[model samples]
Target chain A: MFVRGLKSSIIALESNLKNRTLFFLLNFVLLVTVFIEILTYKHSIALEPHRYQNFTDDILIVQMHYDSETPYTFSSIFDRKLASIENVLYTQYAINQYIYNKETYQLSVKIKGTSGNFIENYDIVDFYYKTNGLPNVKKNELIYGRVWTNEEYQKGESVGLIYEATAKTIFGKSDATGERLNFGSHSIKIIGILKNTDDIKNYYRTFNNYNLEFVVYTPITYLKSDSLIDYSIMRSYNNDILKEIITNNISEKMYFYEREDVISKTLDIKKEQLSNFYYVIVVTLIICVVGLFQLIKNFINQMTFECSIRRTFGATKFEIFSMLVFQNSFVFLLALMLAIVVSIMIIYAYFYFSYRYVYPYLSYIDINIILIIGIAQLILTIAFTTLLSQKIINTNIIDGVKGNS
Target chain B: MYELINVSKSYGKNQIFTNLNFTIESKKFTGIFGESGSGKTTLVSILGMLDQKYTGNYIFNGINITQLGDRELSTLRKEKIGFLFQESYLINEITVFDNLLLNVLDKENKQLIKRIRELMDKFAISDFLYRRVSTLSGGEKQRVALVRALLMNPELIIADEPTGNLDKTNSEIILSYLKSLCLENKTVIVVSHDEKVLKYCDIQYNLIKNGKLERCL
Candidate 1:
C-alpha cells in the first residue's frame, strides 16, 4: 500500500509539473540569495587573513601646489633630504585627449607617475605583478597596456605606457601603440598597453570622465610640470620619530591617512552597500516561504478524500503521515536538483562577465540554507498535511468516503 | 459477528441515533434500510470502525472496539474490516490491478494475486484489470471495489449503498456477489435505500430519524 501511495504520488507530481516548477524556482531563488550572501561573508574571511599592515616606516604625504607663496624650489631644498627618508613616492596626472569607440565617449587621460617604491608599498605584487622587478621609470619612457611589462621595467627607460581598462572603449581591438595623444596640446606617443590588474575592478569597461579615470601608466620622470611640486613621504624607524616629524610639520589643512585606515574605509563602504541589498534578499525569502506554505496547504486540502480512503483501508496515522511526507520530499528533491543546475548556470555567467573579483569556478552552498530550506519544507508539509488529514482518520468514515467534506 | 449495545450518536445538538442495539450474526448478510437522513450511513460507519466519537459499546467478535487505541483500532480495521462504497473510490490515476494489488503490503503473500485474479474473473472484470479506474464502467468499478475488499480476506464487510449507483440488473448482480460472502460465513452488513436489496438479506433493520431501530420484514 505504501508503494502504491508513492507511485500515485509520483504520478500526481509529474502530472503537475508546472506547479512543481514554480515551487522549485522559489526555493532556487532563496538558495541563490543565500549562496551569494554566504559568498560575500566568505570573501571577508579570505581577505581577513591577509590583512594590510601599516608599518610606521611608510606614509601617504601630499604636497600642496608649488606656487602658493613658497618661493624656494622644493627639488633643490628637499630632494636630497627627502630621498634619504626611505620609500618616497610621488604621482602626477595629465589631461589627455582621446575618443571612446564603444559608447562614443571621450575623456582626458588621467596618469599616475610614481617611483619604483609605488608598487612595493601598495602590495600589488602578489596580486598583479608576475615578476620581481618594480616598474622601472626613466625619462621620456612609457609602458603601455594594463600592467607593467618586464621589457619596459628592465630597460630603465620611461617610454612604454600601459593603457587603462577604459582605453579599450576608445580603441576597441585597435593596436594602440605608437599613437600620438594630445594632452593640453602636448603630444606624447603611446608606447605599451597595460594588462588588467586584479586591484582595479572592471579595468576593461569604458568610463565618461577620461581625465579622472585610471587610463594609463607612464614613467614618473617623463611628466613635465612646474606646479606639480613633489608629493613625497618620509618613513621613520620608530613611532617617536614619526610622531615628532608629524607634530612639527603639522598643518591644519593637510590630511594624513594610513594604509590600514584606507582598507577599512573601503570595506566599510562595501558593507553599507551590502546591507541595503540584504533587506531585499530577506523580503524575497519571506515571500517564498509564504508561497510554499500556501501551496502545500492547498495540495493537502485537495487530497482530503484520498486520505479518508487510505484511512478506511487501515492506514495508521503515522503511515498516512509518512506517505504524505514521502510524496512531498520526492517532489522537493527533484525541484531542488533542477534549481541548483539553474543557479550554477547564472553564477557562471556572472563570473564570466566580472572576473576581477577572483571568483572561484564554483562555490559550496552553505549548509544553513540546505538545512533551513530542506528541513523547513519537510516539517511544514508534514505538519500541515497531517493536521489537515487528522480529521480523515478520526471523522465518521461514512461521510469522509461519501465525498461529503 | 458484530454487536452494538445501546450505541448513541449525535451531531452537535442534533441526535441521529440513541440507545440503538443490534447484532449481525456470523455468515449473515444483514441489510440496513432507511430514508435519507435515516442514519443508516452513520450506522454503517460505526460498524466499519470509521466512527469513534459516539456514546456506546461496540463489540466485534468479543473485543469492545470503542475502547481500543488509535493504533489498535487501525490494526483491527486494516486486518479485519473491509468496505464498499456507492461510487468506486479507487485512485483514478492508477491501473486497476495496481489499485487492487496495493492493498496487500506483504509482498510474499502470493495468495493475494491469486485471490485478486479469481475475484476479477468471477466478476467478469478481468478484461479491464490493467486499465485505469477512471476508464472503467460503473459496473466494472464496483466489481473492482469488490476485488479490493475481498483481497484482504477480511472478517466483516461494511458497505454503504454498494450498488446504489448501478441499474436494477447490475444492482442484483452486485448483491448476489455480496451474498456469497455470507455463505463463506464472513459477516456482512450494508446500508441501502434501494428496496430491491432487502430480498437478498437474511435479516433487515429500519432506522428512524427519531433515533430508533426496528426489525423490518
Candidate 2:
C-alpha cells in the first residue's frame, strides 16, 4: 500500500515537472548558501586559536626608541625593575641594523641582534644551524637564515646563515650555506638554512611593515659597543600593572606598544566578518522559507481535485494530508542530497588550492552542525507543508471535487 | 436504508432545504430529479454524509448519522456509502487501474485484483487498464469512476448527475449499470435532470416548490 501511494505520488510529481524543477532549483540555492555560511563559520573558528597563539592575554611588546641625549644602557635600567615585578615572566631585547656592509662580497643587508630565548618565545619553526656539522650556537656566534638547504659548509670562527632570497640574489641559488661573506670587518661563515622565506616576510609585514628577506640574526652580545635595544618582547601574568609601570618609568623619548592591543583589534575585525555572514544567512533563510511556503501552497491548490477524489474514495483526512506531505518530503530529501554533494565539492575545491596552513583549519567543519542544520531544515519544511496540507484537507470535498474552491 | 427527518440546510440567508423528510430503502434504484436550483445535489450530499452542517435526524440503518462525529461519519462514508460526482473526479495523472483501486488499502490482494479485473471486463475498459485517465474520453472516464465507486461494494451508492456529462447512448449504459446494482441488494440513488435517465429508476422523487420532495413514480 505504501508503495502504491509512493508510485502515485511519483506520477503526480512527474506530471508537474515544471513546478518540481522550480522547487528543486530554489531549494538547491538555499542549501548551497547555508553550506557556504557553515563552512566559513567553521574556518573562522578553526583559525581563532592560531591567530591569537602569540598574543596571549598577559604578553606585551614594548618598543623603545632613544636619541643622542638618552642613556646607552637604557634597557638595562628596566631589566632590574621588570624582574622585580611580581608577575613578570621574562623579557627579551632585540636591536635592528639596516646598514651592514660586506665590502669584499659587495653585500649590504639588514641584521638583528636577538637574545638566546628568542626562537622559543617567538614560536619560530624550521630553524637549523650548524658550525662544522655541529648544530649549536654559542654567544657571539652568527646563524645564517637560508631559504632552502644545500651542500654542507665547514665551520669557521663566526657561523652565519643567509635568507633564501639573499642567497638567490648573490649566489644565483637558494642554498648558499657553504659560502662566506664579510660584514664590515667581520667575515661570517654560512652555517644553517631556514626553509620558508615567505613566512618570515609575512611575519615582518604583519608586525612592523619592514622587509624581512635577506635579514640575519646574531647574538645580542655581538652589539657590544652599541648596546641600544630597539624593542623588548615579554610575557607576564599581569599586563595591566606592567602597562602602568612602563608608562610611568619610560623616558620622554621612548614609546611603549603592547601586543595584546594588536590582537584585540584583529579579533574585532574577524568578529565583524562573522556577524556579517550570519546576517546574510538569516536573510537567505527567510527568503528560502517564504519561497518554499508559496511553492507548497500552489502545489496544494493544483492537487485539490486529486485530494477530493481520494477523500471520496474512502481516504481519511489524515491520509489525504499524508499523501501531499510524502510527495513534498520526497522532493525535499532529493534536493537536500544533491545540495550536500554540491556543497562538499565546492568546499573541498576551495581548500585544496588555498594555503597549506589553511588546510589544518578546515578540519573544524563540525559534522554535528551540518546534521543539526539539515534536520532543522527538514523539520521546517515539514511543518509548513503540513500546515498547508491541513488547510487543504479541511476544504469542502464537494467544492474540491467540482474544482470551484 | 437511510432516513432524513426535519432536515433543514441553509447557507447564510439562502435556504436550500427546509423541514424536508425523506426515506430511501435498500435494494432499489432511486432517482431524485429537480430543476437547476432545486438542491438535488445538496440532498444527495447530505445522504452520503459529505455535508454535516444540515440540522436533522439522519439515520443510516439504525445509527444516528447526525450524532456521529466527523471521524465516524468518515468511516460510515468509507464503509457504507459510495460517491460519484458529475465531473468523474478521477486523478488524471494516474492509470485507470490505479484509479479503480484507489480506495482499496491492499492493492496486492489477489481477490481484489480479480474483482477489479472482472469489473473492468464488464465495463469493456479492460483494454484501457494501463491508460492515463486524462487521455480517456468522457464516457470511459465515467466508467472508470463507476468502477472506483463500486470497488468497495458499499451498501449505498450516491451519484450526483453521474450521467450529466455523457451523450444519450453512454447515459443509457450508465443508467443500466446503476439498475443492475439494485439486483445485488445495493441501494443506488442518482440525482439528475435527464428524463431518459429518470425512466430507468425503480422509484423516483421530484424535488419541487418550497424545498419539498414529491413522489413522481
Candidate 3:
C-alpha cells in the first residue's frame, strides 16, 4: 500500500512544483519566528552583569510603601534607613520634565538621588560621565553641579546637581554643563551624560510603540519636602546582606529582592509576550488548516468520478482515502519546509546584525513547535481524509463512473 | 461467470433500476447498449461490483460477491477484475510504464520491472513507455489504460464506452484488441452507444429507457 501510495504521490508532486515550493517556505517562516524569540530572550538575559554565568537568581530590588493616610512621607521614612546599609549608599531621582520629540520608548525608566556614592554603587561611572559633561566647582563657590566623580563623596561637600539631559532641555543646546538650571529654588549644573546599555537603552530610547519622556537626577540633600517622585535606591555590600536589610526594613506587603528579582520579573514579561505569540501562531494555523481543508474538499469533489473509476477497478475505500491524505500531506510537508527556511533567514539576519554573535542565540530550530504542529496536522489530515474517504466508499461506483459522462 | 439476480438500485427517491436480471457467462464478449440515462452504465457497474448500493444477489464463479466486505471486494477485484473507461482514466502525472506499474503491488524488484517492460511492449505502447499520460495522444492513453487492465489478467473486464473518445481508425483498433482479449477466456463486457462496436461481440443487450432489456440488433 505504501509503495502504491508513494508512486502516485511522486506523480502528483511532479505535477505541482510551484505549490510544493510555496508550502515549504511557509513552514520555514513559522519555525524561524519562534527560533528568534527564544534566542533573543536568552541572549538578553546572558548579557546582564552577574557573579556566575547565567546567574539568573542572585539579586533583586525592594520597594517599601507607606500608607497614604499615615501622615508619613515616603522620603522621610525611606531616607534614613536607606543611608545606613553598612558599606551601602543611596540615590533619589524624579521625572519633573521630559523630551520625546524623536523616538519612542517601550520600557520604563527610573531615576535615583544620592550623595555621589550612587555612581559607584550602580557601577555606571561611564554612564554618569557621558550623560553629564564634567562636574567642576570652584572653592567656596557652593556650585550646584551634577555629581560626576567618586572623589566628591570622600571629600564630603554638599552640592546641587541636575541630570545633564534635563539641563540641556531647559537651557537649550548651549553649555548647560556650568549653567545652573533651577529645580524649584536651588539651581544645579549638568556635568555628564549616562552611557547606554541595551537594557537601559531600551528603557530610555524609542521603540516602535512606546515613548519614555525623560528622567531627572539630583543629590538627595537637594530634594524638597514636597515631591511626586515615588522611588528610592539603596546600595549594599552584597546581595545577601541587602536582602537581609530589606527584609527587616520593609513589610511583607512590600516585595523585596535583588537583580535576580528583576530577571524573573522580566521573564514574566517574556512569558506574557510568548503567550501572545502563541495566539498568533494558533490563529494562523487554524486559518491555514481551514483553508487547506476547503481546498482538499474541492479537489475531492472534482475528482469524485475518478475515485469511482478506481473503485470500479477494485480500489478499496481505505486505499482511496490513503491516496488523498498522502497527496495533501505531501503538499503540507513542502509548505512547512519552505516556511521554516524563510523564517530562519529573516531571524538570522536580525540576530546577526544587532548582537554580532556568531552562534545562533536561537537554536535555529525548535522541535517542540514542529512536534506540536505535526501532530495537529496529522490528526486534521486523517480526520478530513476519513470524511472524504467515507464519501468515496458510500458512492455507488456505477453512478460515479456514469456521472462523469 | 457473473450473474445479477433481480438487482435493484435507487437514489433516495429516484429508482434508477429495479428487479433487473441478467447473467454474463465466462469467456464471451458481451455488449450493453443504451441512450443517455438508460441505466446501461448502472447495470454494468452492478455486474462489475463497483455499485454495491443496490438490492441484488451478485454471484461470481459460484461465490456471493454482493456480500463481500470492502477489503474482500477489493482483493477480489484486484485479482479477478479490470476496467477500461471511455476517456482512458490514467493519472496524468505518471509515465505510461509507471501508470501500468501503479497497479503492480509490492513484488520482487526484478519481477515487477520485467512484467512492466513485457506489458508495455505487448500493448505496442513501448514507444510511449516513458511518456507521461498528459503527453500521450488519445489513442495512446487508451491503449495504455487497456494494457494496465491486462497486467493482472483478471477474469472479468468491464469497459464503459471504451471507444467513445476515439476516431474511426482508433475505434476499430480498440475493438480489435477487446475482441482478442475475449478469445483468451476473459469475460469482456463493453458498454457503448456506437453500433460500430457490436461487430466484436458474441452477445448484446440494449437497455431501454423503460427499464427493459432486450436482445441487441
Candidate 4:
C-alpha cells in the first residue's frame, strides 16, 4: 500500500512540474537566509582570534600633558613609583617631533627620540625594511622609514632614515636613502628606509600642529634636548594596578590611557552585530512560516478533486492526507538539495573573492547547526502541509467528485 | 440483496427525494431511468455510501449501513462495492494499468495481476495498458473504467451512465458486459436515461413525480 501510494504521489508531482518549480523557488529563500546566518557566525569566530592576538592584555599607553608651571619628566618620582611595582616589565619614554623646517631642495625634518629598548618592548617588528638587517639605533646612527639600495649604506657615513612618503615628496622618489638632509644645526645622511608611515603619522597628530610623514628617529641623547618628551608607553601584566598607581602619583595636569578601553569598545560593536543578526533570523522565520502555510493551503484547494478520486478508490482520510504529504515532502527535499548546492557555490565564490582582497583565511561552517536548522525546516514543512491537507480532506467527498462547493 | 426504507434527501430548501423506497436483488441487472434532474445520481450516491446526508435505513447483506461509521462504510465500499461515474474520472496523468490497479493496495499479489491481465484481454484493451488515460478515446476510457470497477470482484457494481459519452455500438458493448456480470451472481445497478441501456436490464425503474420510484414494464 505504501509503495503504491508513493508511486501515485510521484506521478502527481511530475504532472505538476511548473507548480513544483515555483514551490522550490519560494522555499529557497528560507534556506538562503539560514545559510547567511551561519556564514556570519563563522566570520565572527574567525576575526576574534586575530583581534585577541593583536591586542594583548599587558600593554597600556600613558599620555601626559603638562604646562610650564608643572613640567613632567620620566625620570621623576612618578617613573620611580611605576618601576617599583612588582608586575612592571619595563618602560620606554618617547619624544614626539620637536623641530620642523622646510626649504626649497633642503628641508629639515623633526626627528623622534626614543630609548634603545623601544622596539623590543612594543612588539613592532613586521615592517618592510630596505636592508636585510634592521638598524638598531645607537648613539648617532638612525633608521629611515623607506626602501633603499645597498650602496646607500656605506660603512661609517652618518645616516638618518627618512619616512617613505617624506622621501617620495621631497626627492620625487622613494629610495632617497643616499640623500642628505639638515635637521636644525646638524647634517644627516639617509640610510635604510621603512615601508609604512601610519604609526608615525598617528603619533605626531596627537600633540603637534604639523602632520608630516618626513619624520626621523634617533636616540634621546642624539636630540640633546631636555624638554622634548611627549609621553611614556609602559608594558606590565597588571594594567589596572599600573593605572591606579599612575593616577595617584601624577599631578592634576597629567592623564593616562589604557588599552583595555579600546578592546572594550571593539567588543561592544561585535555584540551589537550579533544581536542584530538574531533579530533578522527571527523575522525571517516568521515570514517563512506564514508564506509556507498559505502556499500549502492553496495547493490543497487545487488538488481537491484528486483527493476525492483517491478517496473514492477506498483511500481513508489519513491515507489521502499521507499521499499529499509525501508528494510535498518530496518537493521540499528536492528544493533543499538544490538550495544547498547553490549556497555552497555562493559561499565559495564570496570567500574566494574576499580572500584575494580583504580576508586572509576562509571561514568555516558548523555542520551540526546546519543539520539542526534543516531538520527544523523539514518539520515545519511537514506539519503545515499535513494540517492544511487534513482540513481539505474533511469536506464532503461527493461534493469534491461533483466539483461542487 | 439491498433495501432502502423511507429514504429522504434534500439540499437546503430543495428536496431531491422524499420517503422513497426501493429494493435490489443479487444475480440481476437493474436500471434506474430518470430525466436530467430526477435525482438518479443522488440515489446512486446514497446507495454507494458516498452520500451520508440522507435520512434512511440502508440494509446491505443483512447489516444496517445507516448505523455504521465512515470507516466501516469505507471498508464496505472498498471490499464489496465498486463505482463507475459518467465521466471515466481516471487520473489522466497515470497509465491505464495504474488506473486499473488504483484501488488494489496490495499490488504485488500474483493472483490479482493474473486477474487484471485476463480482464484486460477480455475487454480487448491489452494494447493500451501502458498508455496514459488522457490519451485514450471515449470508448477505451469506459472499458478501462469497467475493468477498474470489476478489479476487486465486488458483489455490487453501481455505474452512473457508464456509456453516456460512447457511441451506439460502444453503448451496446458496455450493456452486454454489465448483463454478463449477473451470471457471476453479482448485482449490477446502472442509472441512465438511454432506452437502449434500459432495454438490456432484467428489472427497470423510473423515478416519477414527488420523489418516488415506479416499476416499468
Candidate 5:
C-alpha cells in the first residue's frame, strides 16, 4: 500500500512545479541551518586559544613592534627603575613552521626558542598531554644527550631536541645525538632526543607556540625574531595579582593574548554565530509554513475529487492518508537530498579558498544536532499535512464525487 | 443481503431520509427511483457504506453496520461492495489500466491482472486499456467503471446515476451489465431517474415514497 502511494507520490511531484520548488526551498533552509550550526560550533572550539598549547596559564604573551634586524632584547629600563618588578622567567618566542618529511607530508610544528628551560620546569609535556585529553602521558624526559646550557642559547647556538620518531625520520636513527638534522636550508645539532609520546600523529597541534608532538628548544637567534611573539611566565606568591600587575604595567603598544580573555571572546563569538543561525531557522520556518498552507489550499482544491474517486473504489481512509503523506514525503526527501549536497559544496568552496589554517571541521561535526533538526522538520511537515488531509478523508463521499460533476 | 431499519439522515436544515426503512435482497437487480431533491444519492451512499452518519441500524451480511467505526466501514466497502457514480468518476489523470489497478494495486498479481484483462475484453474496452481516462470517450469511461465495479467480485454493487452521462446505446450497454451480475449471484442496486432503465431491475424502490420497493414495470 505504501509502495502504491510512493509511486503515486512521484507522479504527484512531477505534476506540480510550484510544490517541488517550495519543497526544495524549505529543505534547503533546514539543511543550511544545520550545517552552519555545526560549522560554527566546531570553528568556535577550534578557535579557542588552548589549541595554541599555552600550558602555563600564569603566562602572558605580549608582542611589541620591532625592526627586521633589531629584535628587542629583554632589558630593564634603568631610567624608570622597571627592574624592581622584572620577573620574566625567560625571554622567548615561538613560531609555526611547516616540515615536509621524506614522504612530503607537511606538518606544522612549533619552533620554540627560550633563554632558559622554562618549558621543562613548568611540566609543559604533562600539561599538553592533559589538555589533549590524555591524563597518563609520560613526563617530558630527555632520552639521550644533555640540555643546551643558557650560555649556548644566549650565544645563539643553532641546536634543538626532537621526538625520537622525528629524529628517526630525519636522520634514520632514534639516537641522532650530535648529528645535524637539516630543516629546510638550516641544520640544527641534535643535542637531545625527547622520548616520543604515543600521539606523534598530532604534530599539527600547538600549545602556545610549543609543538605538542615534538619539543624542540632552539636558540632565539635561529628564529625569525621579527615574525615571532614574545611570551613570559610571571612568578609570584599570588598568581592572580601578578597577572593583574603585568596586565596593568604592559604598554598599550603591545598585543596581549591572555588565555582567559581570548577564551571569553571566542565564547561570545560562538554565541553570536549560534543566535544568527537561530534567526535564519526562524525566518525560514515562517516562510515554509506560509508556503505549506498555500500548498494545502491547493491540495484541497485539486485532490478532493481524486481522493473521492479512490475512496469510492475501495481504498480505506487510512490508505488514502498514506497515499497523501507518501506523495508529499517523496518531494520532501528529494529536496532534502539536494540541500545536503549544496550545503556541503558551499562549505567546501568557502574553506578551500581561504588562505588561513584550513581544517575540515565538518568531518568532526556533531551529528546528533543535525539529526534532531531533521526529525523535527519531518514531524512538523507530517503533522501539518495530516491535519489537513483528514478533512478530505472525512468528506462526504457523495458530495465530493458529485461536486466535481 | 442488506437491511436498514428506521434510518433518518439530514444535512443541517435539509432532511433527506426521514425515518425510512429499506431492505435489499441477495443476487437481484434493485432499482431506486426518485425525484431530483428526493435524495437518491444519499440513499445509495448509505447502502454503499460510504455514509454511516445516520440515526438507524444497518445490517449487511448479518453484521451491524451502524455499530462499525470508519475503518471497519471502509473495510466493508472495500471487501464486500463496489461503487459506480455519474460523471465517469474515474481518475482522469491516470491511464485506464492504472485507474483499474488503483484499488487493487497492492494485491496485483497474475490472477488479478488476468481478470482485469478479461473484463476489459468483455467490455470491448481492451483497445483503450493503456490510454489515459481523460482521453477516453464518456461511453468508454463508463465501461471501464463497470469493469472496475465487478473486478473485486463483490457481493453487492451500488451505482448512483451510472448511466446519466451516456446516450441510448451506451445506457443500454451499461444497464445490461448491471442486470447480468444478478445471474452470477451478485446483488446490484442502481439509482436512476430513467424509467427505461428501471425495466431491467428485478426489484424496485421509490425513495420519494418513504424508501419502499415500488415494483414498477
Candidate 6:
C-alpha cells in the first residue's frame, strides 16, 4: 500500500511539473537574497575575518590626498599635531607604494628614500602589530614565527615578516627569521614567517597579479615622512577637539571618519537592502503559501473521485491522507534542495570569476543565518501541509464518487 | 448471507432510510434497479460497508457491521468484498497489471501473480496486461476492471452500474460475465436501471421513485 500510494503521488507530482517548478523558483529567490547579503557583508569588511572585534567605535581613520602640496597631507599637519592629541593610546601610518625593483629581492616594498619620504607604487600592506600581536594573522590565522617585541615597536626597528614561500625561494629555508635582505640601501632582517595560506594568496589578488602574499611587517616610523602619508589611524581620547583642530587645519585636503561613521554607513546600506529583501521574502512566501494551499485544494478536489474509487477498493482514510501528505512534502523538499544547489553554484561562480580564488571569502560566512532561513522554510512547509491534511481525510466518499467537491 | 435489520439513516433533516429491512442470500444473484437520486446508492453504500453513519444491524457473514470500528470494517471490506464501480475506477495513467496490483492481500505474493494471469486469461484480457487503462476502449477497460474486482477472490462482488458507459453489445458482454460468476459460488449484486442488466438477477428489487426498497414483481 505504501509503495502504491507513493507511486501515485510521484505521478501526480510529475504531471504538475510546471507548478512545482514555480514553487522551486520562488524559494530560490528568497535564498539568493540571504546569500547576496552575506556576500555584501564580506565586501564591507575588506574580506578577511568574520568578526572585527578589535576595531572599536571610538577609533578614527584619517585619509588625505597623497602627493598634495605642502601642509595638505597627513604627513605634514597630522604628524605635527601628534603631541597635542594627548592620552591617545596608539598611532599608526599606512604608506604603501609599488616599486618594481629588479634587485636581488624582487621586493615590492617602498621605504625612506634619500629624501626620507616613501616612494609611491603598489604593494602589500606593511604594518607593525601595534597591540603587540602577530602581524602575520588578521584574526584566527596561525603563523610560523613570533610577534614583535615591545622594544621592536617602540624603537622603530627595521625587522619585518615575509611569507613562508617567499622566504623559502629567496633565503633557501622557511625558518630564515634572522636572514637579512638588502632592498635599496636598507638590510631589513626577517623576524617572522606568514603561513602563506590560500587566503593570503587571495588577498594578493586584490593588489598585484602575483600569487604570493609578500607582506612585510615593520614599524610605522620606518616608512613615515614629512611629505606623503597614505592614511593615519589613532585611538580616541580627545578626538572631538582634535577633530575640530584638524578640520579647521586640513579640511580642504583630508577627511576623517570614526569607526561608528564607517560602520553605520555600511549598516545603513545593508539595512535598506535587507528591508527590500524582507519584502521579497514576504511576498514570495505569501505566493508560495497561497500556491501550495490552492494546489492542495485542486489536488483534493480533482482526486476526490479517485479517492472514492480507492476507498471502494478497501483503502482506508489513513492511506489516502498519507498519499496526500507524501506528495506535498516531497515537493517542498525538492524545492528546498533546488534552492541550496543554486545558491551554492552562484556563490562559487561569482568568487571564481571575480577573485580567481574563493578561499578568503569562505572564512567570512555566517552559516547560522543560512541554516535559520532553511529551517524556517521547512517549518512553514510542514505546518501548512499538516494543517491542510484534515481537509483531505474529511472528504466525503459518497459525494466524491458522484464527482462532488 | 447478508441481512439489514431495522436500518435507519438520515442527512440532517431529510431521512434516507427508516427501518428498512432486506436480505441477500450467499452464492446467488441479487439485483437492485433505481433511477438517479434514488436511495439505491445509499443502500449500496450501507451494504458495501463504505459507510457507517447509520443506525442498523447489518449482519455480514454473521458479524454485525455496527459493532465494528473503522480499522476492523476496513479489514472486513478488504478481505471479504470486491467493488466494481460504473467508471472502471482504475488509474488511467498506469498499466492494467499495476491497477490489479492494488487489490491483493499482499502485493508481493507470487501466487497472486499466477492468480491475476489466470483471471486475465479467463476474461480474455491477457492482451491488455501492459496497456495503460486510458488507452483501452470502454469495453476493454470494463473487462480489466472486472479482472481487478476478482483479484482478492472475495465471496461477494457489488457492481454498481457496471455497464452504464457501455454500448448494448459491450453491456451484454459485462452482464453475461457477472451472471456467470454465481455458478462459481460467488454472490453477485448488481445495481442498475437498465432492463437488460436487471433481467439476469434471480431476486430483483426496484427503487425507481427514490423510496423504500420494493421487490420487482
lDDT of candidate 4 over A1-405, digit per residue (tens): 678656656666755556666777787867776766666565555544334322222111111211112222232212222232221212222111111122111111222222211210110111111123342212112244442233433222334555566556445467777776543234456554556535555643342322343455322122333222223323342445444444454312232222124444666787777778777877876777787787777777877877777677677777777777877787878777777777767766775665433244343334456566667878888898878887667877767876873
Runs in model 4 lying further than 4 Å from the true structure: A1-22, A33-283, A355-363, A367-372
For residues A1-405, what per-residue lDDT tens digits would candidate 6 score against the true structure? 677455556555543455555655655565565555554444433332212221121111112122223221222323423332211112211111111122222222232222111111123232222233554234324366664565665565666666676666555478878877444244467777767665655543432233332445554444444222223322233456445444554333333211123344555676676666566556755665566566555555565666676667777777767665666567656666676667667765666666544344454455565566667766766676566666655666666767764
TM-score of chain A of each: 0.43, 0.49, 0.41, 0.48, 0.46, 0.46
Better of 1 and 3 by DockQ: 1
Pairs that clash in candidate 5: A52-A207, A52-A208, A53-A207, A53-A208, A54-A208
lDDT of 3 by residue, A1-405 (tens): 668556666754554444444444554444445444544444444432221111211111111121112211224223323332211212211110111223321112222222211211111010111223232111111133334344433332223343334333444342346554332133344453332223432432321122332233333323334222222323333445444444454322132212223434555676676667666655666666776566556656655665676676667787777766776676666655654555456556765676554333244234365456655765776677677667765777766665742
Determine which window of 10 residues in candidate 2 chain A has minimal summed lDDT.
Answer: A58-67
lDDT tens digits, residues A169-248, model 1?
Answer: 33333457755443322344555555545433332222111123333343322332311212231322343543443344
Cand. 3 TM to true fold: 0.61
Interface RMSD of 4: 2.7
Give the best candidate by DockQ.
5
Docking class of 5: acceptable
Instruction: Report RMSD (Å) for each prediction in the order shown.
Output: 13.1, 12.5, 15.5, 14.0, 11.9, 12.0
Of candidate 3 chain A, the 10-residue stretch with the lowest lDDT total is A119-128
lDDT of 2 by residue, A46-139 (tens): 5554432211221111111111122122232233122322222122121111111221211112122222112111211111233333223231
CA lDDT, every model vs. true structure: 0.57, 0.63, 0.56, 0.63, 0.61, 0.61
Against the true structure, what is each candidate's TM-score?
0.64, 0.66, 0.61, 0.65, 0.65, 0.67
lDDT tens readout by residue for model 6, B82-152: 88778787777767877776554235467888888998998788988988787998888888888888888
Docking class of 1: acceptable
